[model samples]
Target: MAAGMLAGQVALVTGTGGGLGQAIALALANAGARAAITEMPDRLPLAEQTAAQMRAAGGEALALPLDVTDLTTIQAAVDGAAEAFGGRIDVLVNNAGINVRQPAFDVTEDAWDSVLAVNLKGLFFTAQRVGRRMRDQRPAGGCIINVASIMGLIGYRDRAAYCASKGGVVNLSRALAFEWAAHDIRVNALCPTFVRTPLTAPLLDDPVAGGDILRRTPLGRLATPEDVAAAALYLASPGARMVTGQALTVDGGWLAV
Candidate 1:
């Protein structure tokens, strides 16, 4: 890989077994950042495969097991990535998330808890641990990209828990950015409108839901993982050095109306 914008940097991306997390990790590695790809223990094999692909393309990469919901695992994963990447992590992508689609009136307490546990709660603790590491690192600066959703910025049916969790993520990124600015830590949220990933393919394949989404988007199409990955790349690159505490949307004009 030729030296790219992120050359010599180290990035830790969670939930890299597939989907947006995998795409972002590959993009960062291809851009010359050493990547630490992490996933749940059961998904470690898939993450390893992703790392292998990066390595085959001449990019430095490693796969680690991480369960964001568990504080012990979050700390361990952060420490492991930092240790593996020369004791510093230049970028952190808080991408581990889950959604339980159901009407607000029908949403069970368990469902809400599970969604928030992985989406909002997990993301917060992971960012907290990584932010601390970034603050104390010799350079005393780094970037954090939280993968929020356009649903976070707008209302939608059967997504009450998801929307609530992602909304928290958007605001949380801003709060963290404000508090960490003095440490030179830039925090931002990447809100992508309905990307076609494995986790979302079923919904996208539904004629009713899918058609409605396409109609609402001025661009007339759903987002691809790469579309969101590109935005994440910019946030992690030197080009966005002055950018912080903002929600960058890859919604294809979904909110234009």
Candidate 2:
């Protein structure tokens, strides 16, 4: 069990239905933040599970159905979290994203649109809604952590759209961090290499391509969701009060190599 650093705060982690999102949500809750775990209502279940686990551990948590792509849902989730807690939202982890990897030319327009809609397009509007609410709050603004990918820092074959979207995310965080300083909102980004997640399970299961990835990571092992969680915790905690617009990489030294 990691030590608590947040102690007293309200955090919302999007895409909390599973994998990296669930890990971050649990870590925040354990650290004494009243975490709101959000996921789409239909498919994934990590949000409720994470919320329940936190409650059992004597931490405050809320599981709300949220699709980050839907502005209406985004507003409702943020509003609901504030209402359930103390009309305050101290942190928001923008971890919800979608990616489709295929040869650049072979990728369909729908695939490209789908990835951008959730990963890049929706994020701007979602952040806007929360930023406004946080700004309006008295004497206290909020922090926003965008979960980007190493793909943002480097190019990968068959991931042109993904690279572009995440690259946008990285820059957006930097720009927003500078612009929102006056409002006391600190914005940053978390960039990780291809961590093993359900989204990548099918690909990794194919022994041929999976072995190639393991060789690229200098750490000699693929990262788990918990690994990324630790990084997120640092940026979300008071320990990082001065940090903003930074893209902290949690990849297994993939960039170093």
Tens digit of lDDT per residue, candidate 2, span 38-133? 888784466777788899999999889888778889889989988898888888999999889899989889888888889888788778877887
lDDT of 2: 0.87
Q: Assess candidate 1 and give its lDDT.
A: 0.93
Error (Å) of candidate 1 at residue 150 is 0.3
Find the number of clashing residue pairs for candidate 1.
0
Clashing pairs in model 2? Answer: 17-46
- All models: lDDT? 0.93, 0.87
lDDT of 2 at 160: 84
Question: Which candidate gets the maximum TM-score versus the true structure?
Answer: 1
With candidate 1 superimposed using the best TM-score fit, by how many Å does residue 107's alpha carbon deviate from the native?
A: 0.3
